[model samples]
Target: MQSLQDALYNWLTIKVVCDVRPDDKAAVETRDFFEEILTAQHSVSNIETTKDDLMYYISYQQGEEIKKRRYPRELIEIMINQINQEPEKYKDYPID
Candidate 1:
């Protein structure tokens, strides 16, 4: 049997769905914008627009056990800004 660490080393897939109309340009742009930001660290499989929502599928190799949670766009922007302003503080951020 594989050890827990080994299992986690394998790529893990995650999917996030946003409730946005397929034809809304603003929503599409927002989703695409964030997708670019996230893809810097993870692999984005695909971003799809279904009738009711936009679906984002991504995968990344787990560096350490991270608590699964959802981050809003504003929060993400804030975190990025903080990291940029104080690189040393977040140089080892997320404590993987």
Candidate 2:
């Protein structure tokens, strides 16, 4: 506890206290739920990053309408560029 206090004194941080529970049927089947794909339209789920993972999204609300830009455009563009640059490498892949 003393070590934590000393470290916190030098840096800004959030100390969360909660009882951890497994996400069972109640968590997923209930009306309130967050999907594996974070691009879903309804709620924005808070996430904790612990590794080389990233999430990108854009949202806009216009009165009664909720406009969500679901695709990760920048990432998609990078993938497209890779495929364009090496068409022969991806030639064996099937088309939709």
Candidate 3:
């Protein structure tokens, strides 16, 4: 069975790639971008970095349970830029 992480990844990929008629896709993208940034930032601080295995020291484990990852500030900034460049993408979309 696929883990929540895998499912989320699939969802993200679908959300980013698909151009459906829904007005909420943009919001999802923006939210996802911000989430990625935050996760990266937290990950860098709380987790120790190693030259050998990048994902070896990961503290969060996933299985039947859900796990949140660390987002990076740079990622958030990038998403912000995306939103800024395309203002209409995520405008007035309902927050999930």
Would you list the rank order by TM-score, best first? 1, 3, 2
Each model's TM-score, in the order given?
0.30, 0.25, 0.26
lDDT of model 1, residue 77 = 41
**When superposed on Cα atoms, how far off is each prediction in RMSD?**
14.2, 17.4, 11.2
Please give the distance, in angstroms, between residue 80's alpha carbon in candidate 2 and its true position after superposition.
0.7
- In model 3, where do residues sit more than 4 Å from their true spots? 1-59, 63-72
In order of lDDT, best first, we have 3, 1, 2
Q: Each candidate's lDDT (Cα)?
A: 0.35, 0.30, 0.40
Give the clashing residue pairs of candidate 2, or none: none
lDDT for model 3 comes to 0.40
Model 2 Cα lDDT, one tens digit per residue, 52-83? 23333334343455544333334424533564
Model 1: residues with Cα > 4 Å off, grouped in runs: 1-18, 41-67, 70-96
Q: What is candidate 1's TM-score against the reference? A: 0.30
- lDDT of the structure predicted as candidate 2: 0.30
The better-scoring model by TM-score among 2 and 3 is 3
